[model samples]
Structures are given as structure tokens and as C-alpha cells.
Target: MSAYYDLYETPSPKGREGKKSLHARVCPIKTYTQDEFIKHVAAFQLLPKNQIAGALTAIIDDLCDLLADGYTVEMGDLGFFSTSLKCLQETDDENDKIRAESVTFQNVHLRVSSKFRKRIKHAMKFERVHSLTRKQKKITSTVEERKKRLVSFLKIDICITRKEYIRLTGLTPYEAMKELNDFISQGVLRRRGAGRSVVYVAGENLKVE
Candidate 1:
């Protein structure tokens, strides 16, 4: 078995005029090394590998410098970069359409400082937002919150099983099964997967959603 292999037993699809089913399955995420990512970026940018690498490194250094000095850097069409919260002046009218008073972190600005303006002659490297800046934590947090809602929805004492959930939710067989597994792990639902699977029936003693 592969080192990352994980196995899950799914519910059966037999019986109940209209019901859902589950099956044994496993899923794995493809891991990408940093070198692999850089190669892809270099190819996409149509630039020599070394030039792309140097450009990326320099941009990161500049962002770090601005952030360290507690000054937000706003690049006209792009967005601003700064610490969590700091006062900033809005010089560009780029956000005039959306009420000029505020800007969001999602947008990016890429104006280089005047000091470095004359130093870089050729192309001056159009600043890019490297993939490293992505905040996956927010996405992960969202997924968890949705899982919590799923658990609360299933916590009723009305004898709900993985099969019934799939049928009611209209979720694909795989999605229903994955949700069930997540709820089971969260201790909001229980299951016994043997020859025939059954979702543990919660009694009145168990809290209902």
C-alpha cells in the first residue's frame, strides 16, 4: 500500500424504492514540490527560468521591506500590501466605482518605488503575486464551518442513516458519504461499518438540532 493510502467503507445502495448508497473508497491529494511550482510559473510566464526566479525573489523581498517599514504599497491597477491594519492614503482612483473610501485585500497594486524606478531599465520586472501568498487557512476554515452545519443538521434523534441523508440531500453518492464520515469524526454522528452498515440511532438522551 502507498504510504498515503487511506480506506473508507461506504454505504450500500440496495433497497428503499428511492435511496442513496455508499461504497468503499479512498482519495489522495497530489503534492507539489516548490521546484515543480517554480517550473510551472516560469513556463507560464514565458520567461527564462533564472530570470523568473530572480524576479520572484526580488518582488517577495520588496513586499517584505514595505511591510516591515509599516507602509502599505499600492500599485495602481493592482492592490495594496501591508500588515493586518495600518492607515493608508488612497491616491489612485481605481476604486472610485466602488466608493473610493475603502479597498479590499483581494485586489493587488504593483507600483514600484521611485528609488528603484531608474535602477531597473529593461522591463523592470512586472511584479507578480506568487502562489505562496494564497491564504488556504480561510478556505479550510470555511470547509470546517460547513461540516459543522452538516453535523448539526444530522444530530436529530429521528434515526437518520447515511443512506437516508444521501436521498434527502440530493448530494452525489460520494458527497453524502464524505459528509457522513466527517460528521462521524466530529462525534456528532456514529456509524458501524461491517457486512451491513448502520448509522447509530441517537436517542432522546442525545441532543437534537
Candidate 2:
């Protein structure tokens, strides 16, 4: 009955670096297709379904044409639609020259009118829905589990390669290396060879208990 939203950490703007702050993003439960959308409009208005569909199709066609023709379309309180341009070949060099053909409309944007925003705010009730948020990517294995898996693999082979260890346990390259070095210091895994040719062998502490 009410709108649902979830908190998401906003990305830092370009050229700026700081701790990110959270923002509310709406969670849409279902997506309406063209037919479903038209049916909904027919339910709300006195117009026939066919007439509403035809009018909607014509409005979309003309909106696209007018926007392409370089005119901003104003849809009453809904907002203003305008286009923005981008150069095909971008460069930082001050001497570099760009041609007309190189520049093209990159995107179409809409600025929602305050009247429309105010109306929505007045009519809608928002609820925080935590389940709508996507879980962040991360390594899920515990420190002991990772160490145990590596120790087990080294027991089966003469030496475990860095690449094989990474595949066996989904640790990133940096994490794998850091853990491998830590194991070496703890006498849990012995470092063999060097650089790209490096491999790991069982150490004194690696004895299974």
C-alpha cells in the first residue's frame, strides 16, 4: 500500500575522496509492461482503452521527434525534457580540435517540477525495506577455514602454486599473498622458489591434528 525504500552508500563524486554517506533508493516491486500500463491508465480515466493506447503511442513518438529537433518538451507539472551532448574524442590537450561530427547528444534528461514532487510527497508514505538492498561483495570464509583449506591442499601436492591456492579458496591476489606471507612467518606454510615461480610447502605447524 505504501512505497518501500532501502539505504545505500552513495559513491564519491569524481575528483573527491571521503567517507560515503547513505541515501534512500526506492524498491519497485513490479514492472509494468506497455499493455499493463495502458490498462492502468484506462482504469483511472474515462477514455476507452484503444483511444488511450493510441494517444500514448502518439505522445511518445512526438516527444522523441521534438526532443531530437532541439526543443525542450514540457509535460505540465511532470517536468521539462532536454538533451545533453558529448564529444566522441575527448582529450585534455588544449591544442586538440574537435569537429561537429564528433559531438553528439549523449543523453536525455528530465527535471521534475516541484508541483509534481510535492504532490507525490503528500500522497505517498515511505517505509524502509532493508531486504531490498544488494549484499556487498566480500570474502566470507573465516581465517581458520582459509588456513585449513590451504594446509589441506599443500598436503596432497608437492607444492601448491599461488594460482592454485587462489582457485581452491576464493581469496583475492593481494589477500592470498598477504595470508601466504603470514603463514610463512607462523611456520604453518614454507615459502619455496621466488616471484612468479613461487610455491608453498607444508611447514612444522602444518601437521594435521
Candidate 3:
């Protein structure tokens, strides 16, 4: 099946005055989950679902273990996985010395095999979808208005999630994060917990009504 795309108008850069140009952007159809993938592969290979699932799990465990052991894993024609590191800057002082704390793990870099890259390059096809009309951007409430609303909500709920902030203010995830970060910087809100369990609470400076 051909990949589908939609067109969007690009905003003119500063100091440039001309007609806006259209850009083609991919329109995702749907997502295929891991379980569905295992089932599909089992059907084609004539193997039991449990066997295929176990093998896939083992492969992932081994790959992670190998990467953690400072080894580059080559998965046939798929790709290679290897870890990288980031180190702290050196001090200028003659007595200053580098320690284990100065180094940190960065990320796992992937290098795709030429065969897999060639296969995708030859098979991929694109289809243009109907162009979408640009809608006027919604005007969000002023900072003061948002702060008042947030304070009011905190008075009753005590805490809010990234998702809750989006629902409350009709803001995208990135915009919601920016507003939350601003609140934290202004001493109006403080974050609790970390990662997915994180939530926002009223800061010491906040005077909730």
C-alpha cells in the first residue's frame, strides 16, 4: 500500500513577503501493536503464538544485555546497536582531577544495514491526500487568566497532570509543558514525583482562592 500524505501551508520567514508554499506531510493511518505483530508472524510461519512471543522476548532481553555489556549487536540485515557516552568538561585547576562521576551514559546509536535500507527505498511509494484548509488559530487566555484558573483548580484538586493541563487549557502537549515550566519558574507551581508519575502542585508562593 502507498503511504498517504496531506499538504500544509508554510509560514513565510521574517523579512520575506510572498505567497505561502504548500508542504507534503505524512498522514498516519493506524498503529500496529506488538501483540498483533507476533500473531501475524505466527500465522505466516505456522508456529504457535506462545512460541513466537517467547522467542521475541528472548531476542529483546539478549539484545539489551549485550548492549549493556558494552558490545555492538548486529541483527543480521536489520541494524547494529551500540552505547555511547557523555563526559563532563575538564577543570582548569592544576589540582582538579577527573573521577567516575564525571562520565555518564549517553544513548544507544543504531546503524541500519545496507540491505534493509535498500529494501525500504525500493518498496516505499507515496500518495497525495486531499489538501486541508488552514483554520484560524485559537486565542488562548492571557497568563493572568490562566494563572487564576490554575490557582482555582489547585484549591480544589491540589494537583494536575500534563494531560489534565492540556484538557483544562485546550493547549497542545508542548504548549502545556511550556506553561507549566513558566509556572515553576515563577514560583507559582512545583512538580512532584518524576517521569510518568509526575504531577504539579501549588508552589510556596501561590495564594489559592
Error of 2 at 8 (Å): 4.0
Q: Candidate 1 versus the native: TM-score? A: 0.27
Local accuracy of candidate 2 as per-residue lDDT tens digits, 56-148: 899999999999999999988999999998988879987888888998988999999999999998978765554323553477898799888
TM-scores of all models? 0.27, 0.54, 0.52
Q: Per-prediction count of colliding residue pairs? A: 8, 0, 0
Best by TM-score: 2
Model 1 spans with C-alpha error above 4 angstroms: 1-33, 75-78, 85-209
Candidate 1 structure quality by residue, lDDT tens digits, 84-195: 5322454557665554345333333455665456554433322111122223222223445554444466564445665566555554344555666555545656554332
Candidate that beats the other on lDDT, 2 or 3, i.e. the better one: 3
Per-residue accuracy of model 3 over 102-140 as CA lDDT, tens digit each: 978899899999999999889777766442243434746
Q: List candidate 3 segments past 4 Å from native.
A: 9-23, 88-97, 130-209
lDDT, candidates in the order shown: 0.51, 0.77, 0.79
Worst 10 residues of 3 by lDDT: 128-137
